[model samples]
Target: MAHFDASRMLSFDLETTSADPMEARIVTSALVSIDGAQTDMLEMLADPGIEIPEEAARIHGITTEKARAEGQPHDEVLAETVRRIKKAWEEGFALVVYNAPFDLTVLRQLTGSFTVTGPVYDPYTVDNIKDRYRKGRRTLTDVSKHYGVTLDNAHEATSDAIAAARIAWKQVNKVYPDLKAMSTDELMEFQAVGYYDNQENRRKYFESRGRDGSSVNTSWPMQD
Candidate 1:
């Protein structure tokens, strides 16, 4: 986590429809810039192109009717989101997603649905959630509580994004003492091990997700 300079990073979070990326809907997104101390927020009520299950709305608070009224066309929003993400990457910033796998998976699905073509952003390229585990917390809420970071309107894109950045800062600074001394790759590896709750539980999660635990080899990762 400390291997990379915080100034070169961007923390991002997404509020989506479901846990399954292939079937998820990215309702809103946000990014926090570490370099300039600025935050960029992009939120929308996404037209899921299907019914919004009541269970899903309970989590994100975006209903199907609300989305249909205020949300941008699905294809247009997808392209813009992809373009902005790429633009940020080109500017020498790596995206820091909480659950990189989930967010990136949903991003990939959204792009495909829109028929947008190009390389999808690999979230592992900039995940800090793994690093936060050094403190013995796993879920975002626990990390937030441990670090005194308020979710700020919770479920909202910008607030969650900002919270992710704050959590990363607190966790990384604890390990390296100097945020400027670490390499990006080193930081990522540190985060991977740091965030693991326990070797056994971690392995179980991967096995359940159908992941080989090296790289994500299957979409389901594992079955419940």
Candidate 2:
């Protein structure tokens, strides 16, 4: 049997036209659900209806020309995605997001009806909570490396989703075994508190370096 804290976990990710989630337009999104050997992946490309800046396109490799040519309408993609995620959450799967705030905020902005339906877990947030003094960059690539999860495709939505799930699995089964015993809601709350404290700690760290960190979002799963 799979050793995930729950029998099922749903992980999703997105590549968008901007870094600020509130202003971003989705270019690609992926949902990956895993229950033991069975994995279901839904990947969508959306025509963002705006210019995809060169810097953003370079990150996820979804150029404006390609999106305009091959992607589906933004509404169609977001609607289907919302349905899929809601159904999964209703079925009792924990949601895994790498950096939950950014992706969730983007979804919230684009789909007005997309409120997160179930307890959400953020691998990045918990990692910060559990590994506070570890000195390294906390990007998905860096954390996946520390957790020994394979992240061969760095910025791709589908690959990132899978990696997030794997890292969470590692945490549950081995790295942070105590986390498995907590209820999803409890675990989520733990992350929320940890996220807040971590943000404050970061502000202190930055100020110590003669810089300001007050502009960063301290929200847990979503920015607004």
Provide the lDDT at 162 for model 2. Answer: 93
State the lDDT of candidate 1 residue by residue for 1-224, as single tens digits.
Answer: 32344455666667767877668876666656667665555655467667777887887788888888887776666666767767766676766666665776677766654221222222222233334245454566666776677877776777777777776666556633543465655554444444443344656788898876654332211111
Top candidate (TM-score): 2
Q: Which runs in model 1 stand beyond 4 Å of their true positions?
A: 1-3, 112-137, 175-180, 190-201, 204-224
Clashing pairs in 2: none
How many angstroms is residue 193 displaced in model 2 relative to the true structure, after the best TM-score fit?
Answer: 0.2
* Candidate 2: segments with Cα more than 4 A from true spot: 1-6, 207-213
Q: Which candidate ranks first by lDDT, i.e. highest? A: 2
**Candidate 2 residues 16-123, lDDT tens each?**
999998899889889999876899999999998998999999999988999999999988988887787898888778888999999989889887757877878788
